[model samples]
Target chain A: MKGGLFTSGYGPILIVVVALAVLPFGFSANTTLNFLGFVLIVTLAAQGWNLLAGYGGQFSFGHAAFFGMGAYGIALAQVRFGLNPWLALPLAIALGALTGTILGYLSFRARLRGSYFALVTLAFAEVFRILANASTFTGGAAGVLIPLRIDAANFQFADKRSFYWLALSFVAFVLLLTHWIARSRFGAYLVAVRENEDAARALGVDALAVKLKAITLSGGITAAAGCLYAQKFLYIDANLAFGPWISVEALLAPIIGGIGTVFGPLAGAVLLLGLGEITKTFFTWLLGGAVPGIDLVVFGVLLILCVAFAPRGVLGVLRRILPAFRGGRA
Target chain B: MGVRARAILSHGSMMLKFDIFLSALANGLLTGAVYALIALGLTLIYGVLHIINFAHGATLTLAMFAVFVAHQAFGLDPYIAVFILTPLFFVLGYALQRAVITPASHGDDGNILLVTLGISIIIENALLAIFRSDTRSIDVPYGFSVMEVGPLFLSTPKVIAFVATLAVAGLLWLLLARSDTGKAIRAVAKEKTGAALCGIDVAHIYAVTFGIGTACLAIAACLLMPTFLVNPRVGNAFVLVAFTIVVLGGMGSIGGALAGGLIIGVVESLSGLYFGESLGQIGIFLIFLVVLLFRPTGLFGAKA
Candidate 1:
């Protein structure tokens, strides 16, 4: 059963990965590559959000806290401690997991859930943002800048394609991990807890333990995306790292794609970013200038429309329209 | 200097410090009055609808912008604008809940959260698109006037805000306690299915509650215009603190919110005095976290 579980999803997973991997070859334009890389990084963060929210039913409004920790972790390690970028990446990811563990422990220990939990997470993010902004350890408000050196050894690639490939590989790894979790017993336990915590606890499941593990895993994956962001941008600031925008994007992707599905984040990320591009371009043309906030306004409308029309997401819409397209949930 | 002289100097300084503390407390109370007003709307909506209106801040921002536009374009006094904007905003809020949020959310908690969030994003950005990102504040005639009482000087606008807030709260309390609509809202809040079974229009009540809450913001904006600056993101500062106040005051308790806002305001002021302005913001979040963790019901709230 274990072997079959592991093997069954690999075919579709491999096909998706291979298709994404070869996309740079078809459209090697820097703009296209950059867009894809950004989308893939966002997909990683969304996947992290999906793990806890979609599967575990623990909705965090502050995934940015973990994402920012990863970003600051990488930046501080490289710039402040003089650690190698490659070593910094793993440490950064670990730092995010630790943050998640600490926050999850405190919040869950108090039995806070639902909107209370969501608000608390948001408060935590705000606290972190304020601290990071005020402390000299984070270079105050001026922010930290990693000295750029274009080299494969330093994890800084010369070509956009290399960075795109790196991002794709990380996303692919997380996708597989998600696929595994979807099939594993652990996943079943998580779903059970999400469906009804009291019932699951009655059936001998340690709901707290399952939640803690889910948050920890979620944090680490999101931090990896943050780590990648720092590597890509070579800069870090309090707002950029711990902002509500990243948190919004993280949740928006999984929600728009299809919550609880492995590829939902990926599909949602692609569609969201594509929609963003379309809105920006269209709005710019309509307004006769580049204006801020229009894309986000459109996103807000889309979010409401999605909730109203397609509560299950784009995947759900597709399933409804194409009844025979049921290939066993993405 | 002699020992007696030195001791006298120290005593004088201690007296001065006490005076400073008193003033800070007074200032906190005045600022908190406005905060309570902002949070009143939030608590009302939450009590009835059970959804955290993420767009609360944006609506506040929009109202502030309305006040600004009315003043800039029509040369209207903010005090006068309040009467006009409040009713207008009530209608806006009603339509928003009835036409947009209620229909969009479909009564799911998660969907409601997303829809509100989406509404916030749209409203905030729409303001940004129209007003640009620059902070704007009106120069009212009484902007810098001060009221002095027992070694404390309070800004005239803030003092007025405090008095007006109390009046609004009293009015709201009366409305909730006396009116049939208020009884329906209270009934709906306590038991939605029961209220529905009793032939009360739950949707209309929900929209009415939302409208009342948003109307509170219009009043808050008018009161705040003379003293506070309005930017695209300015409402965020109040929104977070308002949430903290709502939780601290007890989720649905009107009196608790008022008291909580005042307490949080004083705490913020004292923290800012010692910890510097930027770091002082942490005090609010800390209180928020603590209240949420330890006393989710708040002081005046009935146990869930």
Candidate 2:
């Protein structure tokens, strides 16, 4: 285990943690901290999605269902039961895991795979969004306020710096956990199944169990991000929690970074989220207000270009570049 | 509780029930025809290419805008614009498949999916930029006309839409069954290599197949103009329904698409009436899930 901890993935994660710790001091801008927090939250979600879709090959288009479930779960628990946000956070995670397990079991047991799996997930997301919109408990289309402002006891942070630290910690924890899982026995079994399910099954891997476990874990982690998002934003809406745009963003990150790798989400989060912020600022600067729908158009075009040209992603490009440095050393 | 009295009362309630049932069925059939026209293009492309064309909705929207422009600028009827637009769309579709889609189709499903998704995004945003997001409908002078028979009422536009659907579907069926080019297309769908060996131009068949699929949307767009408020995002609603229909019909089965469309339409209409409007979409998804669970091959799909 110690030997495994010394791998390249862990080294970068440690560097990331150190950088995050110093970031607040170096950048006093509250807006910058806010942006960083948003990126970390997105990174967590993307990593969670990569576990299942990238590693397990399940390709879910309904991950937003889990995200929304987590957000609404926390909101409902806090508003109705008078529970603390921290207490409700666990419940939110459990809700996501439960829903993910049920969905995975149903779809996998029925032998749904590939495009069918994606369609089923998408259908569920649509259903959940529609339900969220109609339910008065969800505050209907107007959405629900968090009911409490930032109080440490309430699991809300009043300061952007505090939110950034909280988000950074979560990102670090998830990254470490994901790295550990990728090297564990179960992780090996998952990769085996991904490469060739039939062969993995013949070699005594319970393919269904492995996939279900990955899905459950992925869903739980993604929902945790949702919980954080609700606390940070102090509001929850069906569109924010269950939007198809969230799913697209989640899928795009890992694909652009280096799918099925530990640092993929981190790399992707940096590039995509950075570009996104820059684009927003640029558009606002140039057009007076952000050009409506231009970000999506650009993002969509980027996704196509990435798929066409860089199938292996930026990390893959880095891998190719690293050899040149080693050759120079030699 | 006398037999004659009970029998008479039973007959009276049965007649009343029958009337309600028939009216509901008629309403469902009319809507189903519109759904079938939209779904036909989707299933046709899926059948021939094995790629789920995510841009089908966007393409339909583009055609809708074309009709709207023709109506506003040239004083042509929306229906008349179909004749001009359908063939034009066919050529566009053919070119797209040949130049873009076919190269990406070498069993790499992900590339094709992303490409179509990109196309959808591009078209939708471009339309939004050009036309804005305001709702536009071509309201014919006779759009509000209706036919009444006994106790039932039928909208004239709906009836025409249904007839147009049937005529287009029948024409497609005839083409596939009787025409040599259509036969070649079907052969290519069945076995690409075998068709090529038999001297069929496989690439041309693929292009033509996509052409026919896009042409089907022209009819659907014109039919939908009177009923629906056309806008940049109008396609989003139909995309999901069409996907559900295609999956329920059995992938790559034209007859199955027709049957599945009717089933979904009826189910949606009845659920909307009995339950609520929001529940109608939920009902459609539930049916999709159940079908996937119990009959993975779908109602008319061939065994993999």
Candidate 3:
């Protein structure tokens, strides 16, 4: 509660934030915009997860459920019912919260903690994946394809810059909210619960309510990321929407970048996804032909190495390299 | 399914429903045996280490692929393959516990989970790179045959899986309940500090337990080769089953695993009739969530 509004001491982060906002203007190149969009959209989901796992102390293995819901919420709204994608965005996010509320309530009330709690979420996501695959409305295995109309209301744009801006704005909003949560009184209660639920409850923390609230907020943010993903790809499939890989990425970003850090998720996303692309291209060229997911193997090795060597993440490493870059607690 | 059936249908219909139930029960028992073996391996590791081996399913997947390769190269039958790979997987599991899991285990619960998750990612993606994601299966001689016993039908491979599952579980139970090393392992699982105080080699027990767990997977993998297709993503499929069984059976309980596996197997088989294939998996996961929330210690778990 004693921390400032920004984790980067406000000044450096301010410049970074400003640069990110105006980035598309100067560097509207497709590659830059594409990469930014991916990172920013993924950042939304990763930050949500970071808030929950890093701060709230709930290690969820099922964030893909909310991500899938967000993707389906917007996809089904616009394609199945002809609703505007813009209008559907909030609906998607709300649905994410609703799903989170239900699962969170059940799990918290039943006293599911640690890996069991995580497994429950994973099971829910798996269930959703199968339901999506079996249903006729989701287009079954082939997936739902949005009309290629270049309309603002549809959230489709001819230039990738608009997509980048939309993603940046969403990520910025979530980051600020997370910033507030991290410094607020409620945020303290969250950390307390994460550190020791029984003791937190002994001090009258209302453990169930605190956990549920964190999960709901996290779910809503992740769902919005899902919607962004759907809009960017213009395709929604069972696998793409509810795949375990999405959940893995959501957790991996924060863990690798710096779990519980405000900028960790963003940093992790950039490092993992960004490095993933570079290594993939480099390895593919070296080996000749598509190496077929060697980059993922690299990622796995990297994750293990990071966990073993730098449990605190990249921000932790940065802090070690330059002691001046330290303040917030993880 | 309802008493209304008595009023609206003939005795023949009632008998037919009974027959269907019996058939499902038989099939469930057979399938549940295999599920028990797989889930038991997961539970054993968790019991001793207090860490969720997210990569357990991936290791099982690795064993399945090993069977596939053994078949392709040497034409080794899955039955014989199980015996051959058991020692090999035991060594692999032992080395992994020593090198990767041991360090991460001391870090934190999340670290261990994430580390295993990383291992899974590496194993799965490596398989994808090498195998190209095509589904592979073992063609056993009696792979598809079914035996009928008083209106109950059982698949041949499934029966073999059931028999082999029981044998392995029994052998493991004996080792844990009777042997000195098994007592050492149980003591470590129950109280790591106390076990160490008693001069037990806790780290060595951890490795041995992990080894036995992976050895169990080797057996289950070969048993499943004739029934299920092997793919890089097969871990995703079976991990859910193992999670459900482990939760329902109570982690670290051998008999409970068999019982829980049977229950889930029956539920899945019966539900498959109504929900079809993929939805059947959804049903299993739903049960998993329910058990996880309502009874996190599982039915047989008594706060151990």
Candidate 4:
């Protein structure tokens, strides 16, 4: 089992590393790095979502709140307390976990299950967006720009290569963490809880506690991605951080990839971001200009099609293709 | 003499406060009537289907656009265009329900939600593609006309909207209470298998129920066109508010929907007046959270 898992996982991880190393050299410095950074951050977020919705069986429509909180946590710490970005990173993760815990506790305490849980999560995110938009602390609707000049100590990389490396490291870390968790006892509990909450509870699983644990962990990781996103972009705002689109993208990636699988988010982010870039470039080439909202429309359509036909996702498809690669199959 | 004069002034001041309260109450009622109209279809669909039609706002927008096109192409008044558009929308609703929605609603609530969300995206984007995201509004001849009752002034468009709301609500109530078809719909809403066992055409009624729900949007759109600008994204705001209202009123309760819409409207108006404009939606959301925390089944909802 271990050998099979390592072989299947190594294929994609090796491919990603090789591609990352070769592509930056071939492509434009700014464009390739920017895309890579986006993919990394989104992959991290999608993984978090997969843990909650896909594995834990508690669909949260408001995971963006964690991301936004993470971004704001770092931004606030850096701005107010003169903290280094590296120092602020852990703080953001903690805050993200706290937010997730509060949300999970409140909703779970009320016994809000299934779709109600999803909607409440969505409402919480929306409420956060509204608060972010209204508050002076978050810089309101216009958002905040980090004053840090790019440097190694500040965690702000001066060159695109440095940013790419940092982002890649983050993505790799999240991927490994996800793999570890999936194999752990906690993971089995999550699967049991998802499969049948009542049965799991009957068997002394403490379903709520398991779900809250998954959500807390998921939220923390997602928030870490937000910190990375803020660092990469050098700016943060309510719209960018807490927007419904972020939540939608996070959910879509996992669903499009195989939701319950460890490497599903990575597969999803690559497919989605790749297709999105291709479509964007093609449209730009055709029009000699950009069309606003076309990408969104396409993404929405793709999501619908995927949900309608392939609920199991791209990784699910890959699993079928590589039947010999069934080691880590969820 | 001075004490008597002061007492008279105090009594007069109390009358003024009473007058102000009365006016606010009247305005709240009017606003509530409009909310009822917007939320009625949402409640009906939720009641019968047990699915939240996230695309209800998009359907409303489409119906509004249809009316706009009719008004532009044929030079027809919006009130008159409603007659033509309502049936067209009904048919469209029926086809949509039968073809797209029913297959998706099979035991999986998530699938139903996704499918509707997909339809919403498609409809919204289609509108964006065709209309180019430009805001459109009807320049009605009597849009600004108003009637005065003592010190209170009521806009003609708003009054007409209110009247239309009552008319539509009454018709729906009659259909549900008096008509055989309405009874069948109620039967379906109550119990699908039992309705089928009772020799009711469940599928046909489901399609018709959807059609009726969409037709409610037709009336709502016509009523709103003169007063508000129509845009591709406008549906989103309305959809959120409608959802809040539906949840507040309890899922699948038409009367509850009516009351819930009124409560939301009044809350919105008061919030806007007291807390300023930007905070209005925030206020509503706060109320929604409070309600969800305390009474998830809603105030008027039947016990689950």
Candidate 5:
């Protein structure tokens, strides 16, 4: 609709990024920094998921395929061939995009959509997880650990706050890109395909190609999250890298925050992780003992409640109430 | 010769290999019966509701835990526990759909998916919180008992499960074919709005279908407890395998699910026999992908 960044919706995103970028400075505690770093990484992954599922209408339950690709690709590049993490990062993201292309190609060729598409993607992820677990190329069940080198060149920072900044920068860039996509022709085409594939095809939208591009971009973004994850934790096994947990996390954040919005993933990630910590602490106090799954239980209940009462997610709710508070139109 | 010597001798003989192959086939069929039982509920739910219930696995895990608790706390036999838990779960399943899933999802497919996923998360984690993730199994008197058939010996529990599965399947078929409730369910599944126009209660039918599906899980759990372990996450493995079976049998086809389960079981067994144990698990998922890509309608499913 518009050429310039401000008209295309990047202005507000820039403000949000600037605000988030300064968060680590206010909290020197490693716990807070670590929490914020994780939130940023999850936000990036959720944004990737939202790009396809939220915007493009392709609900992939197997995003772990791309996430694991980025994770293992970068890890192997470093651990197996001794490459710098910085160089390996792009390679890993590319590998993730390539995987998205391949997975998208086969499933779309079959014209699988909706639940069928979701099931197939899930099966594909399980295949990857099984292969990774059984094969030595991924270090088998024992997993891989990156050598600790506390230098900026290695993408490993001596201070945790620096890593938080690095993660925040990546998330900020992705948020801008997402805003741009939302304003572009391709995004319109993607949404059109999502709304009604046959109708979109009738309008000559090339639904398959649009979906393919969306998935590729989505995969690359999610994989960037995976790459950062490997660099942060310095260790990943098949279960950790290719697990259903990350897939769930990637989907849950955007759904909770506000699907199909640029800032939804970020807001959703912060709320979800923050909710998790609060729930865990509250449950432990109430129960007089630490319970491991209380937080997840709360997440599940919250997810259901969100779907039932606030299907549009937190941002949607905020938008509804904000106008009332300001005595203005929504 | 002793059983070990016979096994060693059989390893060198073609006849013995054939015998082993037959035995593996038999084992697969037996295991497939339980798998079919698991998929039976999933396919039924899909057939009527037209939504993939992501909570299927967590429900199974819950049923298995029911069996475990019954056996541990009450000294109830798994078979007896099945009769008790089946009705209990029927009510639970009905309440879940009518009270939670229906009202919350507002009948949107995407919302239904997320709601079920959330329900799964709640159930699975609740089990984890309560049980502490310990893998538990019940010891039946027939646990180690085997029955000799020709040149092979089959586990008693497995044979019993096979018989029980067939009986349950037959009962389910008869109920659907003859009962008024079955007619209503079929009518609703065939055309929801039309069925509603015809004065059939679509919501009630949906709940009933879900109840039956969940009841099947109770039966499957009871049968499996004698041979399988129960843990917070144990149902997830079955859930995937059941999805494969439901797809293979064609969604919404009861008979097809049964046949698909047996076929998957044999394929899994043969592949495990040939390939290493861990990698052999890939055979099921690969088949799932191939079928989804090539034959999404499945062997007996109506064309989408």
Candidate 6:
């Protein structure tokens, strides 16, 4: 907010934003938009993880709990309470933040750190999954389905491009928020906490406050993605909402792209999900039968290579190679 | 009270309920003993490497599949497959440590977690590619034999699994306490620099320690084959409980892992009976959360 909108810090972002805005006109079928929409939504979730794990110094292994909360929040709202989907968006994200607050409050208040925090978050997600599977309010394991009334008020769209544009807007909002937060005073405090908690506390940083805020924001963002996911699929289930695979997907993108950077999750989600689809299609064509989760193996190998060869990530490697691009604070 | 909560409270009020509780207890102990073996290896690996190997679950699953494949393809008994797989896995672990894990062990904890997790994904998916996703089970002739204990009956597979686990644990204990290589591994885990000063091959020891850790899973795989089915993702069912046991028993304590295993076993059994099968995970997680928050060092952790 302090700097000019087209400052050096946002050169690449401006290009991407302009391109995405004009992208729909180039393609008539909405195929590219739908694919990119999926990428953007997942990128949104990945950014949330980047904020918490990469910047906030809290590694949450259960972000799916909030993603699920967002999904279930909207599904339950529309199905159980007969609320409009438009009215449900904010509530879903709020529910996500609320979930984050609970997870953060319990773990952070206990002063749990590192693996302890990770494990607790994982446990929390597991519990949520079980509850979703068991509780009638959640429709049990059968999951909740949205009513097939495609009204604009209900956030349903006649054209796939409308949903794509909406998803793009959400992605842009998160990217801008993350850009501002990455340079804010609180963001500095978060970086300090992540670099060294004891040292950060010694330097008068409120470690707990920073972590709580980061986690809350992270949860809300992830939940927002869940809402979009539900909208795109028009259905929600326990596995889709609260599965470990969701958590893994959210985290994997940011880690592979360039953690802690605003564009990292965006690039990562594209690379991972985009590449995954391409490879799956190619392999499926080559072998004539689906290789049964071949994409996971490829992605797994990529993850291993990234950690081993580029532990700092593709952005980190790029920054190292181009000193002029290096803008302080990893 | 909620139906689930009430079910939890009334685990054993009637004759049938009492009988069920007793049977669950028996089942828990037998499974818990085997769980002890799994936890022991995990704890030992973490103790030495100072890294929680995320690929361990995948490795366990791979070992289980090895036995399953050997049995299905060649008609070898599960117990006999143990002799073949144990050494095979050790070599694999050793090679993996030297080639893959060692390079990534550059002081950053997150890298290890991700790399091992990546390995786990690779292993799981590779298995899925090969075997499809269908569950595979082995048939043992004596697997169903039940022994009478007054009014209680214990199945042969469970008893054999329990005895085998205890025997393995006793052997591991003696090895760690008495053998020179085992002591060297312990010394390295306790004090890496000090062990190096005493002329210990640090890297070699690390690799061997990893091998031993993986070898333990081989035993677990074979022993578990009689009672459980194997699938690409079967390791997930047991891995979380194994992790909880490792944390509960203190990071590297053998006795603590054993105790933790038994506790989890009972918890799983009782919770499964009380709360329909799926909700039992909630109980395990709650216990893990409590243990984590209250005592970060764990029950049997050495005083820091």
Clashing pairs in 4: none
Candidate 3 stretches with Cα past 4 Å from truth are A1-8, A327-330, B1-21, B146-153
TM-score of chain B of each: 0.94, 0.90, 0.92, 0.90, 0.96, 0.92
Could you give the fnat of all candidates in order? 0.90, 0.38, 0.82, 0.26, 0.88, 0.70
Which stretches of candidate 2 lie above 4 Å from their native place?
Answer: A1-8, A281-289, A322-330, B1-21, B104-106, B301-304
Question: For each candidate, what is the lDDT?
Answer: 0.90, 0.81, 0.87, 0.81, 0.90, 0.84
Per-candidate TM-score against the hidden true structure: 0.96, 0.92, 0.94, 0.91, 0.97, 0.94
lDDT of 5 at A54: 92
Q: Looking at model 1 chain A, report the run of 10 residues with the lowest lDDT sum.
A: A1-10
Tens digits of per-residue lDDT, candidate 6, A129-184, equal 88898899999988988878776777988887888889889888888788878878
Task: For residue A82, give model 4's deviation from the true position in Å.
Answer: 2.5
DockQ of each: 0.77, 0.43, 0.66, 0.41, 0.85, 0.61
Per-residue C-alpha lDDT of model 1 across residues B83-140, encoded as one tens digit per residue: 9999999999999999999888888897888898899989999888878899889988
**Pairs with steric clashes in candidate 1:** none
* Per-residue accuracy of model 3 over A106-141 as CA lDDT, tens digit each: 988998888878888888888899899989988899
Give the number of the best model, judged by DockQ.
5
Per residue, candidate 4 scores C-alpha lDDT tens digits across A1-330 of 345635546555655566766666777568777887798889888888988888888877788999999999998899878998899999999999999999888888888877677767877887888899999987898888899686799988778877777777777777777766776888889999888888998999988898899999889988988998998887888879998777877887888887887777878888888887887788789888765556667776777777766778887776778986565453
Where does the lowest 10-residue lDDT sum fall in candidate 1 chain B? B2-11
Q: Give per-residue CA lDDT, model 6, range B82-144, as digits (tens).
A: 899999998898888878877864657767777777888899999998899998898888877
Evaluate candidate 3 and give its CAPRI docking class based on DockQ: medium
Weakest 10 consecutive residues of candidate 5 chain B by summed lDDT: B3-12
Which residue runs of candidate 4 sit more than 4 Å off their true CA positions? A2-23, A26-28, A284-289, A322-330, B1-24, B72-74, B104-106
DockQ result, candidate 1: 0.77
CAPRI grade of model 6: medium
Which pairs clash inside model 5? none
